[model samples]
Target chain A: MTEKTAITPATHTVPPAKFSHGVRKGDILQVAGQVGFLPAVEGQAPTVAGPTLREQTLQTLANVASVLQEGGASWDDVMMIRVYLTDTDHFAEMNEIYNAYFEEQGLKEAPAARTTVYVGLPKGLLVEIDALAVLG
Target chain B: MTEKTAITPATHTVPPAKFSHGVRKGDILQVAGQVGFLPAVEGQAPTVAGPTLREQTLQTLANVASVLQEGGASWDDVMMIRVYLTDTDHFAEMNEIYNAYFEEQGLKEAPAARTTVYVGLPKGLLVEIDALAVLG
Candidate 1:
């Protein structure tokens, strides 16, 4: 049996609950849902990256990248991604930002399978993203 | 490199978009978000199990199990599950049904790691669930 290891990088924000930021069992790494909020300073609450959907999406992806790197994986290792948006109307705008991020990372040819759905988020949050990556 | 194969079970409803019911690479199987709707009758729209949250949650679990089985997995192989409910008020009701199902399946000792969040469903759907399973 493959044992599960929780990944908790110092750079990533501490999770509010008992869950870890990500968990890895063998080559597969499953990241927990991530919002645009940055890591809090100990006793402080987490803060959002910005007010707009585009800004939050970018920060959320950055946060995901941080977790991926800490787990010894990269964008190319990601097999699937699930994006949850607070408003369906923001879909197009969110996609534009998401697409560009991958393009900038030079992973245009091997993009991960993706699924997007509209969901309700806590106040002041616009987007949440989670990923599953398979390493070599 | 691992090759990805899509699983499309005849007993499950056809997805509305251009995605497969599940994708398998190596021993890992990733199933797309599944709602409580039953398999369609040819050209007919999919029907929900019932109007209540408990009924819909049970059907949704059934649907997830069908996809897992089609991909050569069972409830015990499931590693994690992410549940999206339209109403946060329904969390307790949903969990009762979810826990009972796993218990009845004799998987009470090691239930799949779970994360539940509130989200918006298209219509007539109370819950949506996605899962990851690993085969031996």
Candidate 2:
């Protein structure tokens, strides 16, 4: 049997949170929930950056992608997505940008199964997304 | 190319929420994020039913198992899990029940890789969990 490896990426300047960002099993990568937090650049708080929902979402996805790559997975390997939004009114905008990511990659096969929830968010962030990717 | 079969269960009254509760891709079953609402019970509100996080988690996992059975998967097939807790303070309680479930089943293999998160949950629910299972 071939052994599988796992990757844990501790990024940015934030001290280690209780949980690792993600863990891989076999060929699958299950990413932890990622909220909209900017990479710390200096003395300012990372969460204070990204004043808009769209911008926060973009940053969140980028963070997810970084973790995915660390685990030998890519956006193309993502098979499922779970999105949490603080407001349903932003769904249209979120979907537009969300679709663009997959569309731009020209992923013509079965689209990644997804679920979007409109609910309260910790830190009062507007959006967050977690991903599952299979490298098979 | 080999043909793959799919299973979609509509037994519960949750309306599948945003999409199908679970999807079988290749040998892996991906279950969507499940909240603490019981579909069979009348007038079940997502937020208020579970007086505690442990109660909510059990109900949520039950809901997930129902869909897994429909998809020809079992609790033993679960390979990884991402659990969302509205408050990280509940982690100890969540793990107490989580360990009980797997221990009851005599799960000895590399324990299902798990990641826990503190986030805003739907309605007033305390916890939610999404899972990935490998059947092969």
Give the clashing pairs for model 2. Answer: none
lDDT of 2: 0.71
Give the best candidate by lDDT: 1
Give the 10-residue window scoring lowest on summed lDDT in candidate 2 chain A: A7-16
Q: Which stretches of candidate 2 lie over 4 Å from their true place?
A: A1-78, A84-136, B1-7, B13-18, B40-49, B106-109
TM-score of the first chain alone, every candidate: 0.94, 0.82
Q: What is each predicted model's overall lDDT from 0 to 1?
A: 0.81, 0.71
User: Which CAPRI tier for candidate 2?
Assistant: incorrect
10 residues in a row with least lDDT, candidate 2 chain B: B1-10
TM-score of chain B of 2: 0.81
Report the C-alpha lDDT of model 1 over A1-136, residue by residue, as the tens digit: 9899998877677787999989998888988898898755677778898899988999899888988998888877776788888886787687788878877887624355455778678999989999988886
lDDT of 2 by residue, B1-136 (tens): 2222334455454433223467666777777777776665546633334678777888887777876788788887888787878776898989999888778867767767888877665456787787878887
